[model samples]
Target chain A: MEQHMSEIVTAAFIVIGDEILSGRTKDKNIGHIADILTSVGVDLKEVRIVSDDEDAIIDAVNALRARYTYVFTSGGIGPTHDDITADSISKAFDLPCEHDVAAIELLRDYYKGRDIEFNEARQRMARMPKGATHIANPISIAPGFRIGNVHVMAGVPSIFRAMLDNVLPTLETGAKLISTTTPCPFGEGIISTPLGQIQKDNPEAIIGSYPKLAESGNFMTDIVVRARSEEVLERTTGAVRALVARLLTEQDTGQ
Target chain B: MEQHMSEIVTAAFIVIGDEILSGRTKDKNIGHIADILTSVGVDLKEVRIVSDDEDAIIDAVNALRARYTYVFTSGGIGPTHDDITADSISKAFDLPCEHDVAAIELLRDYYKGRDIEFNEARQRMARMPKGATHIANPISIAPGFRIGNVHVMAGVPSIFRAMLDNVLPTLETGAKLISTTTPCPFGEGIISTPLGQIQKDNPEAIIGSYPKLAESGNFMTDIVVRARSEEVLERTTGAVRALVARLLTEQDTGQ
Candidate 1:
């Protein structure tokens, strides 16, 4: 596959559940997803946490899938009433959902050795949108689905993470990453103006400053610069270094 | 201040940075903040990740502060050029940016014995939104701000965590949490329908299903029920147990 040069593969995460919005569950999926996507060079642009409402899910799914190269949704796929993600997605794409034979066979094989009964409720897991492919869940027989560019996975952190790992290797990835950082004993404001100038100078590189609160109630800031190309990252980092040096000198001069 | 009986406190998180959007840095702020707020009974309804663009910051700040009982922002408050959160917040609130005497004095006191220069760059940390109070950064002299209901804090995990500890005690919290869980050897689909029925029957109790992926590639789902009152939580949990038992029995009979 010939990859496009300007192809900045972007993805958005939609976390659905009332528990997360209600503050009953602190989400672990975002961090895990973000890290996994980063390692593979896919930029995670936005994350939205919405409730279990069907309209909300449909709206979010539509918006995100339109805006980004891919959309990944976690939660709301179960045998329960609230697990309406599959129905919502089917509605969004105008596709009919029926139990898939391949998925059901996999589920059957999974339960063959165990004493567990594969009931009607359990069979619901085999349902998938027409033309959708299964993202194998090595941990569970109930597979996640990939419909078009959207990957729908379980909400539980462990399962979502496992499903993600299973899915990532199949996707096309572009560049490797290069990053540099410099720590300063100053707050953010002192360097904001200059950093903005550097950013303008090197639009190819991404620059960020993180202000930290020290144990003694003082601020320490770290300026990080990153790029896909190593040479560009080095050049940008050199500029950052000079800027930091000048800022330190200005601090010494009391200006 | 008269607190309304049915009052619900809500919060929104503003994560400002290009780093997170570019996927170079995985954010730790949102998860920590969500956990802290949930523990204190505050609902975290929305989270927005915006770039260091001044207009973006100002817009998000205005919109979030208006909708939520409290708005907390992490990142973009440092001594560097990209750190524009304070100035942006000040502009959003239509407040003047000026060096706060108390904050400056604190910074001076903090750097007294250290070899660090309290120069123009460091002094920038003292600038606060006019009429706003400071949230003490016990870890750093550059204090975060609280203008109206918005709380601005550091982005570093350690510092943000510390500052949150200080700020949390001052906020009013409602209703202690009561929760119980039961483990089931089924995938989410099997339990979804019954879980929905259970939730419909017990509207006040919040029921959630978390599917765990085992090392052997099987699913273990834990159904958790939560409520503000212990009696309600207990009742909901009993219903959940009965539902799970009935479902399992039905599955056995079908097999």
Candidate 2:
């Protein structure tokens, strides 16, 4: 690919639920969202997991919406009394949340011949903030909503993934980042100094060193280099690989 | 157990690393910390994952430290150039970050006659904010630090766990929340209305409904009830169980 650098597209994720905070449910959405966004050239800059409290939801939604290009929230949109996400999003944007006719019709059609009743409780899924468009859920008929720059989806992993598939295509994406990882059988203490110098020499690339404990009780390090430009990423990755090779040669020669 | 309503101890977790945000590293710390805190009577109120930027780290640290009883941070306290968490923590607390004599001595002793060099980059681990106490890291000799209410630990899972083990004994705990989960072989649409009523009748208990898509393509739900009092928790869980049984009977009779 030719060297191309574009304006960065950033997004923030907000997870609203008491179950997650209480450790009753382990979150499966954050990593999935992060991976999808990165593949589509969107940088997930920040993520916040707040409780079901309305004030906490409002604060996180408002703070992230203003700071990033887009904001995505999951959970608290179900039919239970504890699900206050719609109202909180409405309050955060100063928009009134009311029942959307399209969503109501969709849910009614889905439950038409089924044993389930499209009761007032289930109709709660039809509610959305004003000036919002539906993000269709293929697995479940209840639709998620997109208001302003915020996309709200379900908490269930299958529904969340389906809704994200619907919402991603509508977002603005940037130049995808290119990265390479060089693994060394040494600790960060051995390579940290030269790694810092390599980072300075290659100013266009972002280099990170992560230390991992091996299964054999030895410490190993992985040096990752990332950049939007393929040329810079390659050059920086080469420098890291060369540094590791030099360190290995020194050890072999008893330096 | 005796019925008790003690104060609640709350905590917030902040993860500082671009690796986590970029999806290069799936976070293993949030769930582990959540389970540990809940078991120890400390409610994990919020969680934030931000990049390695200094301003971002400082903002998250300052905001979480002010609001929660304790703030636990993982990642970015290494020797590399991008590892600026220690400096950011100092800026957040407005304290001078200097090399601690004790930490330096400990590291020096650990690296004595080893293949690793106790150079400037490795010595960076000895720096801590003024008035901070060291949290011993048994996996690696480099100690994490606690400044005020924020505990800074390593990004590595083993080191983070070790540091948390060292720090947990010193913190204050509260009345543990008692919880029980009841499984229902039905979708939320069938139980939302009665669940809302049960939640209102048992106002002291916090009830949550999590719907899962089963392997056979049927929707199943788990109703969880939590409370600080054993009597309240058991009573509320019983109400939920009764509600589910009634719904199942109605379905059996074609109501």
Index of the highest-lDDT prediction: 2
Q: How well does candidate 2 reproduce the true complex, by DockQ?
A: 0.60
lDDT of 1 by residue, A82-178 (tens): 6778888888888988888999899887667666667677777788788899988876657999998899998877778889988887776657455
Which stretches in model 2 have alpha-carbon errors above 4 Å?
Answer: A1-5, A252-255, B1-5, B113-115, B252-255
TM-score of each: 0.81, 0.96
RMSD of 2: 2.6
When superposed on Cα atoms, how far off is each prediction in RMSD?
A: 4.3, 2.6
State which docking tier applies to candidate 2: medium
Give the DockQ (2 decimals) of all models. Answer: 0.38, 0.60
Single out the weakest 10-residue window by summed lDDT for candidate 2 chain A: A1-10
> How many steric clashes does model 2 contain?
0
